[model samples]
Target: MDKFLLQQQVLDRLAEDLLQVEQALREAHETATHEENIAENKYDTLGLEAAYLATGQARRAEAIRQAMAHWRQFRPRPYDASQGIQLGALVCLVDAGGQQQHLFLGPDGGSMRLLSGTQLVQVISSEAPLGRAMLGKYEGDGVLIGVGSIRQQFEVLQVD
Candidate 1:
């Protein structure tokens, strides 16, 4: 799969999410400032509630903007066995059941799943549990992650 193209796809999806957030922010702001929403008494918190919603929406919009900036600057490099798995490595892992999963390790705030052709790829950050376990691991290496009380195991089938 083309990593560059996958990056573009991620950007496109983020752009859509940003647009929705911006629209929600605008509506929230309007509701907060509308004359009808103004509090008539201490118990009437419509205006205050709307203001809080607007603030949250504004913060969400800002976060999306920052995520976009980070993704724009990200570059996925070619995989090297000697270097082991790092950010931008496209990895395929197999579980004990023989089920395979594909992942594209990337920058933070871009943890999402997308379909690249017929294959589904999960984009993760190095900070994630599984991502941290895969770091510096080579092909045929074993990766173990604990979720609650259960421990899941996977083998590094391939890295590209």
Candidate 2:
């Protein structure tokens, strides 16, 4: 598949997911409010129930909001030399030991699946180690992760 087309598809999917998340959040908030009103007269379980529902809904809503923001920023654009390793780049990398890996930058919807020999590396979001390293970097640039004992290196082979 063409890289641009793939990126756009992923972006569209993320947008749709964001919409769903928003709708879910709204429903959750509404349910929590209704529960709060019902439990208002019953002080015994009111605190516990309201706390549980509110906390869960708030956490999920925050997570989805953060993901939506990240995906919005990573939306694809026309690749220019000046852009370096912006979002939507199909990055090819080789580890120091010569193992190859591929990363398709996109949202965190459990959608990244790339083949490395017989192994598959699942890319999640741009906030991950390798993803962060690749961001704003040009071809031939090297990123070092960790130090000494757990040290690893990745060399950017190509960006598209």
Candidate of highest TM-score: 1
Residues 40-144 of candidate 2: C-alpha lDDT, one tens digit per residue: 455556545554766775676576567656655665665566878865667778998898877776666536564444555444557676677778888899977
Residue pairs with backbone atoms closer than 3 Å in model 2 (clashes): none
Candidate 2 segments whose C-alpha is farther than 4 A from its true place: 1-54, 69-74, 106-126, 147-149
> What's the TM-score of every candidate structure?
0.97, 0.55
- Give per-residue lDDT, candidate 2, residue 55: 70
lDDT, residue 105, model 1: 93
Q: Model 2, residue 8: what's the lDDT?
A: 49
Q: How high is the lDDT of residue 26 in model 1?
A: 91
**Least accurate stretch of 10 residues (summed lDDT) in model 2?**
114-123
- Predicted structure 2, TM vs. truth: 0.55
User: lDDT per model, in order?
Assistant: 0.93, 0.66
